[model samples]
Target: MTNSHEKLRMMMIIALFAALIGIFSQLIIPLPLVPITGQTLAIGLAATILGARYGTYSVILYLFIGATGVPVYAQMTGGLGKLFGPTGGFLFSFVISAFIIGFILEKTRFNISMAFVANIVGMIINLTIGTIWLKLFASLTWEAAFLGGFAPFIIGGIIKAFLAAWIGILIRSRLESAKMLPKKATIS
Candidate 1:
């Protein structure tokens, strides 16, 4: 493909992933400090497939939509309030985590184990930032923040990470076989 065609394809994929993130955000299991949502899973999938730059762009696009009062966040909430709210840090972490996950996948040979590890690291980053934000925003003690934000979501996070890795690798393998993945691009 020409440069323009490749750029267009990447942009389209980014938009698709951003839309998927918005849709996934609605699948929420409300909790005390934070909600369990499919957003992370979508982030992982997008990152693993789109690579670092495009993956981060996808997250940015999603955030932009949410910030514009699109009702794209959990519980159908959106706007600047949601972006600056208690769960905002976790939401923001998606950008970093997706970039990290995509970077790792692009640098390393694609495998379930590598993807699992990358996802775990990404989850840890998200949880750490989210816990700190919860404490600050809610004015809770560290223990309280851990309990409310990190503790409750540990099991679910692990499950989601594994699922993300497994599914992402599977899809990536298929795409590779079909020669749909760009060889010169960062995607792996």
Candidate 2:
């Protein structure tokens, strides 16, 4: 494809992934302070398949959509209020985690093993930032933040990490073969 066509295709894919993240966000297991959602899994998949530039773009787009009052967040909630709420840290962390996850794959190799490691690291980043934000935003103690924000998500994060690795690699390989995505990520 020509440069313009390629750029358009990439943009469309980014938008699609952003929508996917929103859809996944609705898969919520509610908790007192937070919810376990498929948002992370979708984030991992986006990073694994799209790499740093596009994956992060997708996440930003998702956040922008939600912040604009789109019901795209967990439990079908959205708006700027959600973005600044106690769980806002988790939403913000998605950008960083997606970038790092894709960056790791770009730096190493876009394979299941590497993707798994990257996803785990991304999960940790999400938990850390979310916990800290919970403490500060909610004015809770550090222990409360850790218990409510970090501890509750550990097992789910691991499962999602593994699933993202396995499924993301499979889908990415297929897309690469079909020329839907480049074998290696590029900013363009």
Question: How well does each candidate superpose onto the true structure, as a TM-score?
Answer: 0.95, 0.97
Candidate 2 structure quality by residue, lDDT tens digits, 1-188: 78778889999999999999999998989899998999999999999999999999999999999999999999998999999999999999999999999999998988999999999999999999999999999999999999999999999999999999999999999999899985446543
Least lDDT summed over 10 consecutive residues: which range in candidate 1?
179-188
* Candidate 2 TM-score over all chains jointly: 0.97
Model 2 misplacement above 4 A? none
lDDT of 2: 0.95
The CA lDDT at 154 in model 2 is 98
- The whole-model C-alpha lDDT of candidate 1 against the native structure comes to 0.87
Badly placed stretches (over 4 Å) of model 1 are none
Native-to-model Cα distance after best TM-score fit, residue 30 in candidate 1, in Å: 1.4
The lDDT per prediction is 0.87, 0.95
